[model samples]
Target: MEPTNEDYTYRAGDIVYVFYRNPHTQDVANIQEAAVVNNPENPNELAVFLYETYYPLTNEMAVYSTEEEAEQAYHHYFGGI
Candidate 1:
């Protein structure tokens, strides 16, 4: 068995590589969720939440600025993701 999309688990702030479908093509984006500012709650988790404007619209993954920044983004975006 392979990892399905549903297998991805996201946390508050973590940098991720998101693969999404563009208008007529496939695109990949780097995103970072607002949650994992510092260290992730679960380091073992594959996916994590991010707050990059491009992520939402493009369905790309989150790329973290910094551990602290990621955390701050999480709180700012989701009010404490």
Candidate 2:
């Protein structure tokens, strides 16, 4: 199915694509999507389900505002895989 334009935010329940950097991986940079599940236990950190690790929603990496952008970014990174 095609994706629709939607404004994404850091608020809980919003779907977003988070960019990660790993030296061990094939690509130094990677992108993944997860729902915004804020860690109420700690406001200093951001959390999301289905993610390998808990990363802060900071400016160090990219965060696509919508699923459409995420899909395009994924395809671009994975060579349209």
Candidate 3:
């Protein structure tokens, strides 16, 4: 199924920045670039390719279209580093 939010939609090949926390190191969180692509399990849905994994794209994900925007959000949420 598609994302519940109607205001945002990502197409295949779109580059988005997301605030990601390292799975192995829970203390490390940073902004990372991800590629939007069709979900392998569901062609009609979109997913983000990052950290060598595929994640479903939803409104809940801290996704931004540009690095500057992502940085601003990162600083706002993380406060530093």
Candidate 4:
């Protein structure tokens, strides 16, 4: 599980930040900026588009509304900037 903004409500066109791990370099990770959009397969659900992929939006994801917030969280969790 990952940290989430309990008070935040997801909406389409919103920009979000998330921790994205490199597929080829499993040990490397970075904060990625993503866009919130309605799920193409399920309009009622929300998804995030990042790295040419669509990930379902859920509380289990560490989602941040601002870059500062995501950076703080990344530092706290990974202990690096």
RMSD of every prediction: 13.2, 6.8, 2.1, 3.6
Q: All models: lDDT?
A: 0.38, 0.59, 0.83, 0.87
Worst 10 residues of 3 by lDDT: 1-10
TM-score against native, each model: 0.26, 0.52, 0.86, 0.91
lDDT of 4 at 4: 35
Among these predictions, the greatest lDDT belongs to: 4
Give the range where candidate 1 is weakest over 10 consecutive residues by summed lDDT: 50-59
Q: Model 2 — which ten-residue stretch has the worst lDDT?
A: 1-10
| RMSD of model 2 against the true structure | 6.8
Model 2, position 70, has a per-residue lDDT of 65
Q: Cα lDDT of model 2 overall?
A: 0.59
Q: How many residue pairs clash (N, CA or C atoms closer than 3 angstroms) in each of the candidate models, in the order given?
A: 18, 0, 0, 0
Which is superior by lDDT, 1 or 2? 2
